[model samples]
Target chain A: MAEAARPTFRPAHTGFTDTIATVVVWLIAIIVTGVFVWLLSDIIWHGIGQVSWRFLTEAPRNAGRAGGIGPIIVSTLLILAVCIAVAMPLGVGTAVLLAEFTSSDNLFGRLVRRSLDVLAGVPSIVFGLFGNAFFCVYLGMGFSILSGGLTLACMTLPILIRSTEEGFRAVPDEYRLGAAALGMSRTSSLIHLLLPAAAPGLLVGMVLGMGRSIAETAALIFTSGYVDRMPQSLHDSGRSLSIHIFDLSMNVAGGDANAYASALVLIVILLIVNSVASWTSDRWLHKRIIS
Target chain B: MSRSRSDIFLIWALRCCAAIAGAIVLLIGAFLVIESMPALQHVGITRFFTDASWHPSADASQGTFNLAPMLWGTLLAMSGSVLLATPLGIGSAVFCHYYAPSSIAKFYRRLIELLAGIPSVVYGFWGLVVLVPLIRQLQPPGPSLLAGIIILTIMILPTVALMADAALTNVPAQYLRGAAALGLSRWGTIRGVVFPAAKSGIITGVILQTGRAIGETMAILMVCGNVVQTPSRIFDPIRTLTANIALEMAYAGGDHRSALFVSGLILLALIVVLVSAAEVHSKGRIYG
Candidate 1:
């Protein structure tokens, strides 16, 4: 038995398998990321040098050479503005209700919470269908900027409410009790105390929701018709960057440069919005830790 | 005191906003049901479920809106994507948790986060230009089930990886250390002890990822080729329920509309089953 114990270092040449697995995993991660980059490269490699400030300012090309995304840009900003306007009050208002006044398991409260989750889960295309039927066919609003913005507002509502609710809950109950000791009502305490503390976080959630809305394509495609024109009326159809990229790529007839360039621009926009959100959340977390 | 009363009233009113958001969801389900009723009555539920025949363009006199083909296609594509993504996702997660340098793991997390950030439509476009061509090189046609699976798999990789990594992190270090102390190698300890402990979480993540695959629409529609036929083979073209609904919703008439709603209901049911099972399995067991 002592002699047998001496032979433990036989070393079964397992290096090959371990090395192979490590390399394979690393390569897969690299290649997957590279493909995403390469997609942008394929488009910008063709169209980046061609775009100018003028390209961003002018209306889309009618003659099919190389026009700008001015209308798409304006429309996107407009829709984004409209969505923010709708979602902010709606989302923060709901969050405050859940955090302060509503009792747990209240039927309507539970229903609202569950509904928000379900709304978050429903596919974008389904939302598109609803918008088509309810907004276009039933409401007679047609495929316009207003319809698209309203639908987007609905899409962003859940994120805003959920995040804002979390923000409100994070504020200490001690603060509320202290405010009450000073003859402040729950609402007064929330407005003057709880809300200010929650403001940074509620704002972050709004940015994230806006990013999600901006990056959205399927929901907007049917709700907002692929109108190439700048919006003159709320009823006027307008193209956002996502729609423009989808449309151009579908034809393969529209220059590949335009589509790729549009995608690159849109991706950059999303990154900016998402980063702002991430930064905001991080700052709040750090502040909470320090205090 | 009057100010306080107004404040309390404001809070009560704010609560209604939350109710409205939730009401919107129930309304969507109700709306879909109502819109599809005409088709439901005309076809009779039996034919819609049992029959594999779908001739949307067929003469109405013959009566056909068979969902069987579309359902089969949906399952096949999801199954295909799950098969491709799950192992890679788990592998990546394992590497991130146990093997990669701290910097590398952080980078990997950020990369996956960015991947998740890309809109579904961009994935759709990439599939159109790049992935389709790559698949065509392997097979003759540009758009096939293979292409759809490849795109969907890539699209879901970040979600699965993030969840799996969280699961792995949740595994206790004590078990791994105890295994190592007893005379196991690092890999051996991980393979034999850590992974088993993480199994419930891993399995739940896999099921949830499957649910996501089942429900995904836009990226899938772009590459699925949108044909209405039973999937014959791995490489054959097919139409998924989501694709069918997207492609036809513009002008679907009568039972054709209800057939689409039935397709959606089927999808919702599949997701509900997967989610409920995971919920039960994961209730208190998952560490992360």
Candidate 2:
């Protein structure tokens, strides 16, 4: 009778504790969601009014206090182009080596992965120092778009390679076996079959890398320079979108309006890119399932 | 058989790409060391640890290159953000995993990803425009260590929550079922079985976020008052190592520039240690 009473009494205590824990957890969830909503709305509320057609098409005047971010947009695109151009081939090739050519325990593959992991964690400001030292000073590139793009390439490669590797790894082993049975040369099979199948992964990696490179500021500050003029050539210095925002807000007094507008444009670009990535992956998944 | 030539070429090309990718890390390390050598030699390494303030001058002799205060600032901001984020992140993760409907959990995850995708500059801008002003009402000077902590906490919260969610999801379903079989309540089971099973993964995530928090630059630089001091109070302004490099590197030249690189080198060394520690902690774990 005593033991039964003890078990019955425990429910009252445990039940109360459970209810409190559940309430606390629900409260935390609501708070986290509320914070996100607040941040998004705050930016959108102030910035949406500032963004206009003219804002996207014209160059800034009075050190970004007036006019638009026309040249900054071009510079941002060119820098991104250079970054992707350099990173894609190297990233895809490395991913191929990791996923297809090498075994899981291969020493060289492990070394490469370890290095990439360390590289991914390296601070962007440090990358700025390295890029300034190597590309600008030692290589005599100065503070050009080329230098900044190359710096971004180094920063973006690890993310690209890792994701692409995962993409390749997700392909079924039977597909490879079938290619072998069909007497398809390894190069041909990888080029024709593997690449297409892993396209979603590659797309994801590219979008993520682009997003990171586009949003970069510290790495570009010392390497790409602070020039806000229309870039005449890849060799010339040009301020990127993020760098422009940093400068406008921090240095140029009364530059907040344009800063908010530019930030809105950047956020829009990121949202579009993210949506496209997910949409494409979703379509790919549907196609794969249907077939 | 003739196609074998192309295959061989493709193999070699990939090998070369992998080699280059691996070598870039070595190259970055080498360049940082070479660039920072002048400052390290001129100022002497011991002084960096012992000096009282950072006053980098064109003349190397006159400047005091002590990084201790900034180092302290970086660790303080990093630890504070991590401490605040850990509970909030894990609580959200737990909420999503056990309590929320699947649809709500999915939406929440997407929201977290969107939060993560926002650039650091924007966070800093937001912090400067909104958060700092709010804090200023409570305290006189707004752009202090507290502001940086709050901004950093928001910036890293998504990372922690997402990683923690993944870790929680990776917990074996059998563990929960076993607790249920033993008549344990849901929260009781989480406290006793689920958390213990997922401890290493959550720790690894936290450590990785620590690396990110320490290395973060633009956000902290924008809001933090950029004062070079060891902050005694949370409201006191502070400068981090990353911010130190970004702020001073533009006008810095000769040994001053080299000293900035020394700071960069220190940051890189710190990151390498954190990454290694995470790897060691997650070793042999499935979630790694």
Candidate 3:
């Protein structure tokens, strides 16, 4: 009512409104950050006491109620090894094919891209079902590490392919033209130049895949029988760290502490792997900038 | 140089490897259909979808493999979590993009990424230990759909927020400047300009979150007491398809196992639809 008399360019309470907006935004940000901090502190506080050299190296006793996760660690690593072995080559090859060999406008390329998207969204539990039906029963692997590893490999493939493809696509056309101008064969050029350039970015993908493998629980439950001991061979059933955490927390008496400890370890490993991934990629970018 | 023998062989091999990647999706679908065929044939597809009961091992005279309850539970939990998460995630993104100082925003974004990178099983553990207990003080029978929904909301928040932040950040600054030139308030500019510009992306993020929520197993399984009944209230126990498979597949055999495969098939179908919808939505935006 008094706006004309006041002769003000802005509303009277504009500053107040801005303050309110800032408060609300900060409140949300803090709450979100608070929840994460709480979760982390809870795990670290409870789990820190349990991490010991013996805990890392010794075998479980009395059905995993009162022992270490040594074998679980080994089995986890072994399954990861099997997974990366299969997924790395297949994923890198697929990425190379999509980025280099095919045009995105073509039907085959479109179909492959769509299929990759669909695969990326496929639930881990379905992978478990597939692993059970195809690898475990039909293939008669019988709830072994091989079945779990194979299933995880399949699950990791999409992540690997997508990231690697992005890495390849990020390589400018000038690099390829430069190589071709040198009279090098296409295969030789790709092998010597493009792949190495993409390797650092692909490492990020591999680390992410490794993180997924480490974190997986539902997919491995049925395929990898919840055995507590060290695996004798690829055919032998074994428990992974995630599965052990699940089984112990749910099944064993007084297993919550152990579960917490295992979870803490898993979280720490994930953080380290992810940081390593970013750090390596950052280092590569830094070098590129410097040069 | 002309293409060498090794070059041709390498190209052929790489193409085959690419085909293998595509074949994986087809293979999973084929295996699921094949494994589920027996159950589908026995139950009749219509009855399987319409039946209210899910007794896979009933007497030959009274076998009812209705999946309505699990389906309902999955939809309820997924939608509930997404509804709870969407506003919060988008709000966080808005704050990060338009409100916060750069240093604060950077730290906040890092925290969100850390949250995203935490494993689902640990979330399950936290739900079982911290969240459930906290809920118990307010409500009895803490392991309920509400618990599952809350845990899912937390799990998916980082993803949705990150996607939304990217979308919001990508909104051309010219629009913001134009809105300011028109004397629009900050929230007004965001509502009228930023939101419309980023509509497709936010929907894609929401759809992606839905896919993850529906497929979520470990945390939901731990928090949502696995009762194969229709949940009437937020505090009621319910089962999701993912949880059902994870809970029963261990000891299941015969038709029960095949029936589990059918559940997996349904989940696969849901994911395929959601993912393709998201893909189409993103593609449409890319051109327009």
Candidate 4:
């Protein structure tokens, strides 16, 4: 009876047009892949020659025409640290509040979500202008590491909040129900159960946020003056690796090789950071599914 | 009344933090409006937006603040890039969804992800080092509108491809099976049924790509030649709104600085409208 009721559909031979379409689409995909391989090989071939101990450790001279990027590397790390420090807590707190505390259907929740959407869509250059107006001038932080960090924090806040909120939403509702049955208070359950379960996703967001802070050049170009020396404190102006790459490629004549090398380093850093974030997220997801 | 004081305190603290996140968006809007007020007042909104010349300080008596050329350049570059990217992106999506084997599909997906991860500055570097010289052979000025458009097309392809792939995959298996049962060819099914079903999703991706193309700066800055003129040909040099602000903000002050802020404001307004439109379309249901 079941066999009779099931409509028998045989696999049909593909027509010529179908075959042509498939082949064309396949060629297109291969071309995109080929482009990627070409870009990577081109950069790595030209850039790998510039990386060395001396290159990484010594301060640049001759207006970045020669020497190393030690100060630039330090300043990049410093700026990232400050950006993450300011953004992480505020972002996570807001995500937690939105996910667990408030009803998403509520007007306030809707408004908050809309605002985040708007913020996330904003261009980085606008953030540069804002940093120049608000942080460097209005707040009197000047074009220092602090100003750049703060500027990045604002740029990254919306991203972190959205990602963390997604992370929270990924938590199964059963955990909350079980905690309720166990008479666990809302705060305690969030601290002890929901947070531990959501830790991996949150880490993914944090790492991604770090990547944004690291890759940022435009906002930093304004809020952080292009000073070549190693910054002794947050108040002093600094140059990040991305900014260094920009300056070398644009401002100076015949600084192409160094720019390529620094770009290789930047891409390498980004790859490592992205891979770790995805790997951690996948591992945690697997573990959650297993036990 | 029975709630613990600590619980109340904790809730309030989290709420305050959340409010601050929302408030930042409003604050940015307010700050841009206020900072740009000087330019808005000096040139008047009509002249600032309508004038084609961008002499911000030709003389104390009269400084031109026209935004026509920059706006024209921004739209020209964005439209040129997005139009070029859309078909290639959709084609790649079709390949991934239908043609590729599982291993090849996975490999291609990872390649696209890595492409998306590459920084805009790296794109700019490659453009300056490789693309510009290549273009120089064709056009005397290497950093032309064509270069910017090409760089942006490459940058946005991965984003468009990924989004489109997701949309294509989300087309129900039942639809494909039904078409197959009806004796429709694979290409016919994709074109007549699957494409229509995934239309909204693909539109969403294109809208998102448009936003990115408009907002892109560093790469365009490196290659757009920073000419404050309307581009008559693909190889003509032009200055986008983003490049204009980045180019002059360092030395600009008083009314000149305010003019830059006003440019930023216009950009912000444009982005908000695009993003909001994308959001609305994404939420809209097309099929019964």
Candidate 5:
């Protein structure tokens, strides 16, 4: 210790601690980043060449056979449709009731708002079980697209409701007062002026909600059983890209190669959807800021 | 027409539905109780929480339940991840907001956002492929809590960082400028002014990350080795409540199935505490 304090005996260590710290940070960051990239690369690098025209169009077959994400793609779109239809209305309606219609002091208003927040926090796995218990056993819908979609609705409603509420709340009060002074009815004013004014933010909410519903796998599992065939109706069982990825990762034997490709595709889709969400939101909000 | 009775009634009705969100939480509580009653009747509540064994006959003719080990595992895994992530997450957030060049900070922010967009399964597989083999080289030959914790730390980094960054950003810029004018060093100004202002926000982020770590399923399921024992060491594999529900529900029958619902109930209770904490903090105006 005395030798080190002499400064000459110190091991050429001006920033030795900093060098070690930087090395450690880079190691941690690189490994984390590399693992993320490897997960995608392992899949896409192997699967992309196979992701030809036929692969996209054809159905997935038994292990190692030819198949595409056809049914999975349709299921994704279908779930998105059903989820948006159910969740958006419930969420937007709740938001409307909160922001414009009801005073928060009322018991029901407080209840709705809090429950939505709680609902948002409920884990996906629990939602899956709830879906299974209520919808599968009680409703007799069976493991179908509709049931999964509806369950997803329950899952994403919080996001939609809150965002929509924010959108409505964001509408300037002055605009409404000015409309009223110009002799517009409240209903007409809300529909023609307020809703239109809040439209972009509301749309952003819907887009983000759809993205969430699309990415979900766990909740839909119990309610939407794995089916290889295309959905005949809302009652028919189906698989989604997310569930497909889950199924492959779990059910496959040694051939983890396929799972990698699927992971890449899923990551790509997620990026696309999220970017679209942000873009739409920025554009919408930008217009609002200017207006 | 002037506002009328039906219009008011309809508005009230909608408000009633709006409040249905709160009722939904109650309904979920009730639903779990109802769903688990048969199982609870079969096995006393104490047995469910105390007993260590979880073997149910394939036929489910025999009752089987125990959650203590899983609960221990859940707590252990969450604590591991939170302790590791909080410092690094908050530190990175501080460095980016206060130290890094604006472009570099923005880049890091974007990187964190993209990380958030990656699905849990991808994270799991990344662990399965990379972490599992890496762990095997160590003393352990299985998934283990360390792997799960490390993976979870990364998973929650974006979430904690974003929230904390927002909190720090919300600190009045004038505070930092005032501190600079007082001749304090840059680090001292941040330590003295910015941190105190953002402490509540950072705490809020830590709490939320805890919630995420506790509730997470898929990644933990894959990386936790799904062992049903209380952990003796960080490398010791263990099953968590979320993993317990996931692993059993697919094949669980009778009481076993209902017990999984009971697990859900417990998780719901945990989440309520989290939500209420956030609500309390929000009401207290704790730097939201």
Candidate 6:
């Protein structure tokens, strides 16, 4: 009866079909991997010789064809500083509210999450327009680093808030229960306990936000203006590294070497940030497991 | 007493932050709408949809503000990229999840993340220098709709592959075991069981990437040849709505600037619709 219950015979050609499918899957994987390797190697092979100490320290002499990216580097850092300073407080506060203060199904929390989802999905070009209209024109900031930084702050908030919320949520409930049972004040407990425990998540979110802001081109092009000179004040127009790369590659003839070097620098910065993020998270996880 | 007061203050601050974060989206929408009003009133809304070309002139009377061609171009590039990326992305995810050894899978995961981190402009530069020249060998115009599609496919592949990996990982192990107990082959189990379980997630990933492809500007602008027309062939030079705004906004003044804002408004609306669809399709995952 048991033998009869099973299929009397196996389906024919199943082996052939399975083998074919496996081969197709393997081919697809190889192709995808091959593309990635090709892109990275191509950039590195052409760009490596151009990256040098002088290239990193001097301003361009002949329309970005001759000099290093010193001023551009300064501008990028200043804009990034302004972006991080603004985004950090707002992002963390919102994340705390959603993860700690409100229930999952709370209406306000849901609304905020939905809005973030929409904002995250918004095209960066739309953000560029909004920044141009609201920050540069309406606010009378003109085309300056201040406006660019603010635009980036707005763009980075969605990702930062979402990730930080996830980070806060990951803290085990037992810790919260223990803190409350010990008569620790809500504020003190949160400051001393929850924040430290969630540091890895916070770091990851900040790194991701920084990466996105640093890579941004469309949003900064109009708000920051196209000035490659070192900006003395936040109000001064400045150019970011990504914008410089864009101008160099598209508008400037014979600017390919500098463009390649700039791209290589950008990729290296992103790589370091990414590794730091993963390394911190891994260390944190190991520490927790050990304790 | 002071500590409790500070706690109260902290709570209020957080609430304010949350409220502000939510309100920013509305503010952006409102601003875009207000900025676009001049074009809407001057050119009339129907002209945007009905006109045949996108020739924005400083003189409103002389300009034709037809956005249809660019709109079609945007959709075409988006759909074309999504079509090419979907199979490749899902296939790679399947390979990573089931076929590769654990060590190889981990390495592949890192590789995809690194791919995602590369900036759009860098990709554009690469596409312009390498991909365009390669394509031009076969076709006269190197920067065409095909180039845009290829760049976008690479850009959005990571998004789809990562999301699909998550979805596949989430599939209940019991289902796989049950399939094995029934003597189903590995391929049969994946096709009949894993795919069905992860269908919603995979669909959501594709939709999300579609939004990404639609919004992408710099790469498309760099490689798409920036011609304002509905492309009749894959090799035809085309302009996306995003490229249109970025290209003209710099010198555009008067009604022309307003017309560019109108394009931004449309992109915003399309994004909202896609995001809402994704949320609904994901079936309450937002709250979860």
Q: List the residue pairs that clash in candidate 3.
A: none
Write one digit per residue (lDDT tens) for candidate 6, span A1-291: 000011121333368778888899889888889988999998999989999999998988799998889899999999999999999999999999999989979999999989988989889999999999999999999999999999999999998897788789889998899988887877888899999888788888899999999999999988998999989999999999999999999999999999999999999998998788778777766777787
- DockQ winner: 6
lDDT of 6 by residue, B73-154 (tens): 8999999999999998999888787777667777888898789889999999999999999999998888999999999999
Off by over 4 Å in 1: A1-24, A63-65, A102-108, B1-3, B49-52, B57-63, B171-184, B192-205, B284-288
lDDT of 4 by residue, B1-288 (tens): 245566677788888888998988888898999999887777778987676578896231367888889999899999999998998899987766666765777678778877878889998889988889999998788899999999999999998988887788778778877887888776787798889999988998898789889989899999989999988988899999999988998888788888888889999999899878888998822111
A best-first ranking of the candidates according to their lDDT comes to: 6, 2, 4, 3, 1, 5
The order by descending DockQ is 6, 2, 3, 4, 1, 5
User: Worst 10-residue stretch by lDDT in candidate 6 chain B?
Assistant: B279-288
In model 1, which residue pairs have backbone atoms overlapping below 3 Å? Answer: B39-B255
Docking category for candidate 3? medium
Second chain alone, TM-score for each candidate: 0.89, 0.96, 0.94, 0.94, 0.92, 0.96
- State what share of the real interface contacts each candidate retains: 0.38, 0.65, 0.60, 0.58, 0.30, 0.69
Ranking by TM-score: 6, 2, 4, 3, 5, 1
Candidate 3 ranges beyond 4 A from true positions: A1-21, A285-291, B50-52, B58-62, B180-183, B284-288
For B107-151, candidate 2 gives per-residue lDDT tens digits of 887888788888899999889888898889999699999999999
- Candidate 4 - CAPRI tier? medium
Model 5 error, position A207 (Å): 1.6
TM-score of each: 0.88, 0.95, 0.94, 0.95, 0.90, 0.96
Tens-place lDDT digits, model 2, residues A69-156: 9999999999999999999999999999999999988999988988998899898898999999999999999999999999999999
Query: For residues B141-180, what per-residue lDDT tens digits would candidate 5 score against the true structure?
Result: 6689998998898888777877777777777767766775
True contacts kept of 2: 0.65
Expressed as tens digits, the lDDT of each residue in B1-288 for candidate 1 is 356568757866786777677677776677677766766666767887666577753233466677887788888888989998888888777767666776777777777777767787788888987888877798767677888888888888887887777777766766655665676544555577768887888888788778767777777777777777887777777888877787777677666666677677666667657756776788722223
The candidate with the higher DockQ, 3 or 5, is 3
> What DockQ score does model 3 reach against the true complex?
0.51
DockQ of each: 0.39, 0.54, 0.51, 0.50, 0.33, 0.55
- Candidate 4's displacement at residue A108, Å, is 0.9
- What tens digits encode model 1's per-residue C-alpha lDDT throughout A63-89? 224788888899988778877888788
TM-score (2 decimals) of chain A in model 1: 0.88
Candidate 5: residue B120 lDDT (0-100): 83
